[model samples]
Target: MPLPLPPLFAAWRQSLRAGYAWKSLRGDLSAGLTVGIIAIPLAMALAIAVGVAPQHGLYTVLVAAPLIALCGGSRFNVSGPTAAFVVILLPITQQFGLGGLLLCTLMAGLILIALGLLRAGRLIEFIPYPVTLGFTAGIGIVIATLQLKDLFGLSLAAQPHNYVEQLSLLLHSLPSLQVGDSLVAVVCLAVLVLWPRWVPRVPGHLAALAVGAGLALLLERAGLPVATLGERFSYHLDGIEYPGIPPFLPSLAWPWQLSGADGQPLQLSFELIRQLLAPAFAIAMLGAIESLLCAVVADGMTGSKHDPNGELIGQGIGNLVAPFFGGITATAAIARSAANVRAGACSPLAAIIHAGVVLIAILYLAPLFSYLPMAALAALLLIVAWNMSEARHVQHTLRIAPRSDVLVLLTCLILTVLFDMVLAVGVGLLLAAGLFIKRMSDLTDTAALPKHFHHALSDLPEHVLVYAIRGPLFFGAAEKALSVLRRLSPGVQVVIVDISAVPLLDMTALAALANVLRDYRAQGVGLVLSGPTAQVRLQLRRAGIQRVDGQLAYVRDLPQARVKALRWAGGSKT
Candidate 1:
């Protein structure tokens, strides 16, 4: 049975005490504070990348981090805005605006909760390794491209949505690049690249942000033409204030009041919702993949087992709640989680503390964020892109993986770049599944033996046939077994199927066996099953094939099967 949803407050209380040791509390607090500092800039930068306000990113960290830590099974997982979600959410927000995007996130959260309730958390493990690599690499490319405009402060005539068009526009705008912005970006990039080597303990990205912000401020005072956060956005709470509550509330939104660019109500048509369903599903799938993958990484570092199902539920609840607060989609942040562990977090309480830190920053430090330059944020994301791409893994996959996997990898990469993440993952999964079925079918085989009579075998009767089954009997291999059974000669008094060598049988294989039995019985042949594995026997019994007349003669060994076959042949004669 599937596990029930855990009580949220109870989980929070449990998390506070989990992994508790007086020796580790001080270290955990230090680590939590360090991670909080690192996550602040990243959370804001990812929010910008997704076309949302920086505060929304802080909202995600505030709500998602603690909620996931409390309800999730992972000891050190910090959930919030991640680079992977940026690839998916940006297009959604671009196409549908923030309202529709919020609805999609809500739907995705519900889907994730359902998956957790259905105990489908382990399903993420089935995603092909190449497919993940391809989309990740493609996402990195997209993120890098998005950063270019900010990196150079290019003033394009228009921003394009597609990657190719975006690049073309960026190229066209190269002449408009501001020298001041370029200098700031270069400095930020340098600090991000070099600070880690020297300060090993301090986060280089945070240092880069500080340096870049200072440079931008200095340049602004010196009368250089560069953009700051204040130029791009203005915060207004009077228009439509979202309900503010603790992070434990379920995410909900009334779609009626949200408006589009035309000042009209947002589209709430069923068709639009239906169209958005695929994207929502894609978001949930990628969330599952990225979150669970991060959790696994945390497990390796912390030497703790994570409940994948519980984590999925927590993610679902976090996402479900976040959209109402004007937050975009979220997932486990691998970089942040690793930092939390390295900082010496002892338990989930450290994650909760990190969330508290972000909330404090959001409420008090909003204006200070206005001084942060877009170029510096871009540089920060550039580092994030580089890390997420895992170029070394990409090269390794190309060298060691099979041609088919490489083909899948390449296809997913191209589709993600040319179209969208939904299409890429869909096509990649289909291709992978098809190749797997083909491989399994290739490994499956069946053969029939002709009837033989031996005088030395006096115990044996005439008109008896024996057929042997080997290898896994699954959907891909069922056809071969059926074909062999169909080829059995007429007038055979007894047909014995020897299945001892068959290691597995799925629903399709069981159905094939039933059809063969029914066909042989109609042809006046006595059918005997022999030497089935324990699992195979249980399956047959469950499928109502345990009895043959008043006798149950399923055998456990070859010798017993041979003797049973002889008796069946003799009984037919009598």
Candidate 2:
């Protein structure tokens, strides 16, 4: 057999076929510049949130954005290091360092590629809404909480891994809050909240960060030092050191060659790969969900369709290539993608140009970025967390949603906050699946058919009983729906079961039916299966439930079944 064609660059090809005009290119340029300005502060802040140098985040956008745009299935999706990754990436960085984190990203990229090749992108839709909401809310809470140290300028001896412990540490260190940092954070936050209303044309984040950086510089001159990016982070080149981010393009290098948790080279081994497998899978799953959801949102905004599998492959390629360029796990940022659409993005060229904007910032504006206050970045992330949590939506859902859905939501939320996303998602899916099965089973029912419903059934022999089975006969519902057959009275000479309404019959249902047949044979009663749909009939015969002398019989409809039952009753030994 010939191999199937790969779903590569599907969106790019589609947009090309649609014909790009100069007008479209102009729109793309405008959108790219707009979103690029928005992404700069966000990327740095997310990298800081993940316990890495801010440059790595910029590197992610520099590499991943253009690659995803060139190869992905969504024309307007802007891929980058997003706030959603902080909860997962922070722990990895703490435990494994940059090298381990990058290696994990590489593994996740491969997994995503495999998922795309298997055509599993559409499966993301099966995840229940409550599950997504709960985990996101939990993640938002975690991200917001982690930013508190910087937001308050609290000095910590060490950061703990557990959420409760982290909270305790933050509370204990609250007395050490630097007034200068608090002032910077408050001013930056005010600007972020109000700038959009004051100047609707300009992005709030850029203005807020600019104001915060200026405030931090003034505070330092006033003998009240608030920590800035240049003060907290530095990089070495040749022999001299550069403050904040490095002003250069990302160079190629192996992920495993970077520093580990102990500030030494990470040892790449089978055991290490095994250890990272679970986290890698988690990254891949989350990336797939985030990217596909973003693509769907873009589709709704632009009235355009997306090729989901092609998008997955493109994301996989971006992630796979990014680690070598000092990038971390990246996905389509929803807010950025929304901003792209609102800024008049017309094609993948906009995303490609967004990458160009980031590249320009790295080369020209890198030194100035060092002046951005940590508190300002923290303040920015606080807003991100607020938007991400969707607290109002969660409240509405709790009020109006079914109790089972509420339970799933709360369970996922609590688990995610306390433990991790992997456990939360796994348990939530299993719980949802079990609840769904119970609900489906409740809908399947078997009951005696009333003779008055059909004129031909009205004169049926008193010794013959006809029952109708409805709904799919899957495992959960099979035994309960078919158990009625075992309760037939001893005086009953023949039982006609009408199953035309049944839409499916699984192995469990077949087994349940076989048990029913055996019980009827033992009771010396004839069984007539009537009105079975073609599928049900095939299942019945395949399970060896064929016509037997005076034991079992099959008929096409209720009328034929009535005749069969009457004839059986007449000749029955009972």
Candidate 3:
């Protein structure tokens, strides 16, 4: 049902052609280590933001990063869990739990794989830039709002589904804030913000995470009020009280074993799987956009070209496999990719090594992760949301873009925040397509020939009239163009349509032309066509429309149409 992978795997192809040297290998190693450290906290943070265990994020990185590097076309793209998936994944988890997420991811992976095999990577650009901007801004706002409870260490008894309700709940619970938790969250937030600027060589999130974990331990030991991951999830390993995270390797997990929040067992029914299709499609679309955009940014930064279709296939394989290994959705993370490029990464080896390095950290450091404050993770998410909002881009678009485009942007933003990504994108695309059609229609025009052009004809005959059509004679503009025929002079005997400027025509345009021709035939006027381009010529001939008053004649140029019209008008005898 699907095509095979390209002739050669992208990473191997690059290695063969680019001459992977020891010098490049050295650069790849350095960049890989830097990005690996940088990627660690982000992976954990993104998973938590989506209401999953921190380890799920790490699982995604361990599984997806290396696979994408091996199969993907972009040498520098860093694939893993990202903030962009949070909005889409949150509702799915809340509704259907982890099982639904796994199944949805699997379905999305299949779709992406098909897209790549079909070489449809270039179709991703069809989404309007304004629509993406609007929805991304909306997701950012939603993410920030969702984190408010953790940001303030408020004891919200239950999380609300909608943004406004979540904010209301946060405000209501603010008085119940834990002082130590609040303080630790603020300190971690500050470190995450300033650490990169202060220590340029080290990854800031890891530093902030350490700061939060240390403060959390201090508060817990001192018997102050704080909520560590240990307090929420208790576990035992080797007769020790492991705080939160489970020590793990890449191991297969069954998707059907998922349970609901109320601890109800999962059922693999047809209706349930059918309901997930929309969300799965949304995930696929978001993944494609995020990954391709990351690759584009990588290309620009490194002055390297990436095969988008190959990259999509690679991402498909990563997502398709990760869910079985206790992981969630993933894509090419833009920040890490940019970091890899800046750190002198020469190939996908950097990304592969990054995955390996994170795996090593998982073996050694994951045990201590349970002592980290949940509020600290929430703080990291706040910074991520801030970056994703792109407030500067929104402000600039509003100031400079056309009013119609602004409307699309605002509509998409509102819909996304109030509804979901799928609905927002659907409505936004509809608006864009409608606007495009209207603009095209506006460009097409029809006009009767002015008096000065009569001399170019074989002989000036009063009953032979000419009309010129300009711009694309497609469905959108066809009706308007044909309406000009209604203004034909009463004594006109032959109608000559000069289609020299018409680039192409569709079925709707042909139907409209047929209607106009029938109306002219009712008035005893014959029609002569002129100067159809090769494609349009085929379409007109296939239409097989015959003139009722006289035989329909197709001409090579305007003068030939003039001669045909003269014959129809009895001009040779004159």
Worst 10 residues of 3 by lDDT: 545-554
Q: Write the number of the candidate with greater lDDT, choosing between 1 and 2.
A: 2
What is the clash tally of candidate 2? 0
Clash count for candidate 3 is 0
For model 2, what is the alpha-carbon lDDT of residue 251?
A: 88
User: What's the TM-score of each model vs. the native?
Assistant: 0.84, 0.98, 0.94
Off by over 4 Å in 1: 1-22, 218-224, 236-256, 261-272, 447-467, 482-497, 514-529, 538-556, 563-574
- What local distance difference test score does each model get? 0.79, 0.91, 0.84
Error (Å) of candidate 3 at residue 238 is: 8.0
Model 2 Cα lDDT, one tens digit per residue, 513-555: 8888877888888888887889888888888888665465677
Write model 3 residue lDDT over 1-574, tens digit each, in one string.
8756562267557655888889899989999999999888788878878877778888888998888888877888999998888989999999888788887888888888878888888999898999999999988888888877776678888878987787788888989988888888899889988888899888888888888888887887788767766666655668987677776685687765766544676787899889888898899899999999999998899777888898888889899999988789989988899999889899998998999888988889876777778788888888888889899999999999998899999999999888887888899999989999998889889888765866765355778777889999888899889888767887888878888899989888899888887777677787888888888888887888634534665677877677667767777742
Segments in model 3 whose C-alpha atoms lie over 4 Å from true places:
1-8, 217-224, 236-241, 453-459, 546-549, 572-574
Residue-wise C-alpha lDDT for candidate 1, range 96-180, written one tens digit per residue: 7777777888889989888887889888899989999999998888888889998999988975878889989998899999988
Q: Which predicted model would earn the best lDDT? A: 2
